[model samples]
Target: MHFEVPKVRMHSLREFAQHYFMIVLSILTALGLEQWIEHTHHRHAAEQASEQIEVELRGTLDSIHGALANNARQVAPLRTLKEAISDDVRRGLPDAQINQHIRELKNDFVLSVSWPSFATQSWDVAVANQSATWIDIDRLHKYATAYAAQRDASNWVTHDSTIALNGPRMVDLRTRINLGKDVDPVEFLGILQQMINTSTETSGHLEQTAKPIERALAEATN
Candidate 1:
């Protein structure tokens, strides 16, 4: 008896093609889903960061404005006391009263002057101590410069206003205090106040803008 060899069965061409098509479609779908998930996650993270920045910026602005107002108030009492003492001294008032007033004025002046410097120092510390990324640093620097310019201008106005108020009538006192023609204290103080206001505003804006950038950076990094 002769045995016939069995023929091997093969897959039809259509079935082979269908199998490969399904595999390709599955892989593409998986990749698409992964991309969508990643995009959504990044967007959420960015929004969170932006919100945080906005809140922080507002707080910073409030702190700065409060400092400025404090500085402005402090200057007034010290200035008035100084003027009184100086006027008494010029009019040949009793040595005891003059001396006492002078002492008190000196103390007040010292305290009043200390605040503006302190406010500036605080700002410096806050900005300088930040350990943000380079982009953040750059953004901060720009914000700071603009703020500083505004502060400087405001300070000038305040000084000028003060000087204008005290300069004309108190000739002997002005001379004693070395109040030059250019030294208008009121204007200077006004200018200083304006500077503070401007700086506060600018800082607010910067603080607001920073949030978005931070979010963007976070997303990019993620």
Candidate 2:
């Protein structure tokens, strides 16, 4: 007797297809989740780096500001001395006495004040290196250099003028009645006063420009 063979079931084929589709869907979902996690981690790391940079910049700026403030304070006495010299010359004090006073003042400025001014400049250079913002770095460097150059130039000019008025030797010409006869006190005082005024104005401008940098640093830290 011949046995009848059973037909393949259509339902089984459909069930197998559904099982494979479910596996593919699950795999796709896992891949998507992994990619999202990696992206999030990378973003977090970048943000952390940015925050650390900002903190460092702020600390640098604060130190720079302290140095600037101290330097400004040191300059105050120099301003007073300059004004006094100008006033003395205007008052017709003997040229010899005025020259003597100016020489002493210059000595004191070089000995006592110059170091702190130089220190402030060093701080500025350091800050320029630490600066993250281009504007802050550029402006600070420019202004600091300008101010320092101006101060040095003024000092040189004053030194030369003093030498000219005092005559070729250390002898005070102002005290010599014959030499004083030819000296123009007004012109000498005018030159000194103009230098003082320029220095003062430059200082004010630097101070004003520094505030924005300070504020930006503060905000970055916060």
Judged by TM-score, which candidate is best? 2
Taking the tens digit of each residue's C-alpha lDDT, what string does model 1 give over 97-171? 654554444444323321222124434434454422222454445445534544654565456424423334434
- Backbone clash pairs for candidate 2 read none
Query: Model 2: runs farther than 4 Å from truth?
Result: 1-17, 111-222
| RMSD each, Å | 13.1, 12.6
List candidate 1 segments past 4 Å from native.
1-10, 85-107, 110-222
Residue-pair clash count for candidate 2: 0
Worst ten-residue run, lDDT, model 1?
110-119
The lDDT of each candidate is: 0.46, 0.48
Give the range where candidate 2 is weakest over 10 consecutive residues by summed lDDT.
110-119
lDDT of 1: 0.46
